[model samples]
Target chain A: MKQRTEERMDQDLAFLLRYENIAWYEDGVVKILDRRIYPIRVEHVICKTYAEVAEAIRQMVTQSEGPYIAAAMGMVLAVQEVKDRTKETILAQSDEAAYALSHARPTTSRQMQAVVNDARQVIRDALAEGCFGQALVEAVHAYALHYLNEKYQRYTRIGQRMEELLPQRATILTQCFPGTIVGTMLRACRQKGKEVILYCAETRPYFQGARLTASVACDMGADVTVISDNMPAYVLMNKDVDVFLSASDVITRDGHVINKIGTFQIALAARYSNVPYYVTGTPDPQHRDTSQIVIEERDPRLVTESMGQKITMEGVKGYYPAFDITPPEFVSGVVTEKGVLSPYELDRYFDE
Target chain B: MKQRTEERMDQDLAFLLRYENIAWYEDGVVKILDRRIYPIRVEHVICKTYAEVAEAIRQMVTQSEGPYIAAAMGMVLAVQEVKDRTKETILAQSDEAAYALSHARPTTSRQMQAVVNDARQVIRDALAEGCFGQALVEAVHAYALHYLNEKYQRYTRIGQRMEELLPQRATILTQCFPGTIVGTMLRACRQKGKEVILYCAETRPYFQGARLTASVACDMGADVTVISDNMPAYVLMNKDVDVFLSASDVITRDGHVINKIGTFQIALAARYSNVPYYVTGTPDPQHRDTSQIVIEERDPRLVTESMGQKITMEGVKGYYPAFDITPPEFVSGVVTEKGVLSPYELDRYFDE
Candidate 1:
């Protein structure tokens, strides 16, 4: 029944390119949907090498889960490039590819590192076992498939978990785009006969919420309203915001949940208004505390302009920190593969 | 000594069109510097009637103190329309002009109302004194002069008070650009040997902070860093933000201070980080409580695009409440003509 609902949700939301094959490695080439002009334009960045794939991630051709999935595919392409080489040389190239892809976006560097590195580990183990050429490339394909599978698994559980947290009818206040988490969650909720009203923040300097999240939510037929990031406090003050849910780039063992730039402000407003704020993700076991998490400062061109059109006064430099950290106490819960975990319960995520 | 520094700032920051005469009633036409294309293209809107002037204000051809000052100039234009008529008809036309201009920007409606109505009151007094014809037009001119002088006086006090608030070198966090207050304040601070590093929020949907505030600030020879409105919490988290100051649209008698949409979020972020939050303005005596203040819901087109370019996905709706109310408790102090007044001490303003 749940599987049928999921399939139907995808059908309804087909207008959004997010659910399509946005990133993949095929025939020794890496291709990604250029999300910079998403919905209005469907242009893809075709990459042939690891460096090209790295540049795609850096340029935000595909961001959030797209990068996570793309990096894994990038490793597969790296294997394809060195498929003619010896096992030792393939291992070296795979390691280099993994390192480059992970550092593409700094805030999610560690989490991304885990994805590419885990896939690289598989290639290394196969090489160590004397695997080479086409056999090693097949092993690389396995790693890409594994990464994609893990991502889907998390999405499956998270959407189901969130649907349970809500009643038959729910009003969700979410920040940034947070990519497809809210969209999938709302779609899954609808599958369960739950109605959702999503209030999204049109995350500034990027417009991710308006461009990305709203596309998926609206296309999926959920009731969605996009607001400027500034309006969160106003909505929380006067409206009935049932839950504040957003995706975390990285959540430390200490419960420092980092996401988009405005998430901290939204969480703070939620706390003040007595609204329950949530983050959808498992914690990163590597980062012991908040200090280990590096917040991303993007180029000023992004904040000072929109779609290459200069918006602000020229020569007025802008600081665009792409992400912010929300201290654990401010979070009501962290929706994970298991269930709604308390911020402190993030430590248990590593147990698996 | 203070006068010398002010003159120097005007000379240094002359590159920005903001410091020029932006609005004036010239030869029976209300000519306003078109703000939508500010700092990039210099253009003016020529309004020959009250409706045209009101539409200019509605389209944000002039904003902040520009509308406040321009609305007064608009009334003078209304008087020009009926210059050949009796005092009673001119007075009636002026009231109609005042009402039209006040509703142009709702969040600042009362504040704008006060500017136009105060000028109308001057016209009423002139009529009561048995003044008419050229004499009434002369009285209308006096009203415009009185308004310009009052705005300048408030600016002098605000800048002077802000000058006292800072140390020799301080990093100040500001929001929505808040107009020439920061420009004049930084100028006065420089005169007092206080070098300030201003971190401005590029208030989204309108880009006022970036286009208006930062233009004046950078031109004035002050070191300015423009950050997005999404960034206050991040800036306050690690940066040495000595103060968070913004201008209020209205400060109620009960102390609810309304300003740009993101002010409350910034204030909350400031409070969380223990940074002193201050608003530069005197309270409105007409609004007895928070209930009296009206929050504005602006057109979504402003948020969906910038500089005539569509930045977000098509078909995605946007909510832009041009202003947000910062409760008195969130405000640390109100920098006024007298001194830095406590938020609760606004009642003393009414007493005077």
Candidate 2:
């Protein structure tokens, strides 16, 4: 690769192409991408107070790493609110701020909780040093910058591994958007002068593929094509698909992958069609099996409507489970920051 | 049965419910239900001439039996248009009228072409017998009524056979709205004091399941739930699914079933789960295999948008194959007017 990972991160990262100003500090406002209406319209949720940041998380203005960034930004906004107050009040309010921000999306990602806890610890250290003036705000901002930077480096590792594994001019079928995980991978392929064609299934209810994946891939110089969720099997059955790669929300020790609702079905079809299907991301180390993982059943209205528009008959009931489990038997590999790990070698792959 | 097939056909055969007035004769106009904007909006395409009827067919304003009925009504309307003209002109225009109607949806169903051909023959005999006035119009009307009656009877036989096979209170997962084939079957099941719960996937681009099937099922006294196209595999994997019955657009001699794009995937999941998957309706006697059957590649805009709203990123292409082929191994039964035939018993089913 022409640009090394350290060189890329030091100057201008590839994330600037689309998400440059999506999450940033402006005056006293911590702005985040309002992902609810993404791809259709580019808008941001401006958080003046920590509560607004929490509400944005609860309302799902952004998801995955977006939540972690938003939560860290919330802490930055938290210290700004109590600058005029006493030192005791500032210390008391900061803990409350952490609780409010982290609890907004409690089950989001372990990284999000770690970022929140780290930010709180940074605040505690600043207060302990008896420098509650400018040192405190600078410390929180430094931690936020480091948190996102570390996350990007992890993404770079995953992308490099994906670039090494994915074939040139590959037809990759993917489900929901996995933040910058797929975008970085496509960019990495672009750096090697490889043309990566992505077939993105428009994940229903949330439409993560349509609103996020396709948009991100297109902006990153990849040829992105959107297909309805039902069209994946047909494409796999007809086209000369090189691989089926998706980002997993959770990967158990037994290699059971769980992500968006349609991932399992795509994996099933890929298994039957003899297509190589891989889940590329970091797996939750604590999760041992599918039964322990809690699958969220979303409100039925999300499925019956789109972009806040009702598309079904008045009396029709909708069944909407946000995610489904794809047992290890259907999965071929798990491409992670460490390396490309097979389903059977998941335990050993993480152990090292 | 509480309602005899002939008795119901003479009056209201329950095609109403949601698809009411889709095809009907009103004064001098042949009004066809504009199925494109169905359930959400009830509108009709008034066919005043043969060309308008052909255009309606091209626009997909009606499908399956709706097109057959619409075509017959268009013929009756065509006869009315030229009844006051000279006999020579009347006979010439009638032949052209039949050509226009039949070619409107050639690959739709063989029954449609046969009905159009039958009406044309009736017109030819009427003109040869030296009848040129009210007798000719009555003859055309008789052919239309007879065409609808026979089609309904075929539907009745298929519905009855389906009723015999489907378990009571069965949880059925269905793909695209299989026109009145599924609605009629559910009605027959309902009539026999059986309760069937349906999981209807809202077929993308064209919401046949959400806008047509689930609406009709609910109005016909069956419990129906609408799901996004991606939910079918999850439903089959988790739910106590009794059967997977989809309407076939074209069922080949070797038992290859081609229906809506999502049907093949559902069949795959069903086969893997050991759920009985059936393709209801008459098999096309002409097509010998899947390769012979032409799959329509629909406009990509239909996939990028939903119910007239754009849902994809700009510059993102969408691949929308309107129909997909499911091999014989995925199918367990093909319910027809003859009987509930096995995939391998297709030739024998037609032979009898």
Error of 1 at B139 (Å): 3.5
Kindly list the per-residue Cα lDDT of model 1 for residues B1-352, writing each as its tens digit. 1333333223322343333455666677778887777667767888898778888988889777788878888888778788779877887899889999888877778778878888888888888888877667767866775666567667767888888889899898888757667767876887788888888887877777777777777777777788877789999998889999898888887778888888999999999999999898888878888886677777877777766667556556667777888888889989888888888878886565
Q: Across residues A1-352, which tens digit of lDDT does each residue of candidate 2 receive?
A: 1123423342223232233444665587888877777778878778899889988888878875677777888888888888767878888888888888877743444535667888889888888887575567767877787676777777878888888877777788888886677867876887887888889898887778887888878777678889998899988878778888888777888888878788888888898788989888666677777667777777798877877878777778998887788888888888888888888778777574
Candidate 1's docking class is: medium
* Clash-forming residue pairs, model 2: B22-B33
Which run of 10 residues does model 1 chain A get worst, by summed lDDT?
A1-10
DockQ of 2: 0.77
The iRMS of model 1 comes to 1.6
Error of 2 at A195 (Å): 1.2
Estimate the TM-score for candidate 2. Answer: 0.92
Give fnat for candidates 1, 2 and onward, in order.
0.63, 0.79
Write one digit per residue (lDDT tens) for candidate 1, span A301-347.
78777667676666777788888989988999999878888898777
- Tens-place lDDT per residue, model 2, B1-352, is 1223334442323344232365666577778877778767878888787779878987788875677788887788788888978977887887788788877654554546776788888888888897777778878877776667676677778888888987777888888877667766876886888889989998887787887888777777677888898888889988899999898878888888878888988888898788999888766777777666667776799888887888877788988888888888898999898988877768876674
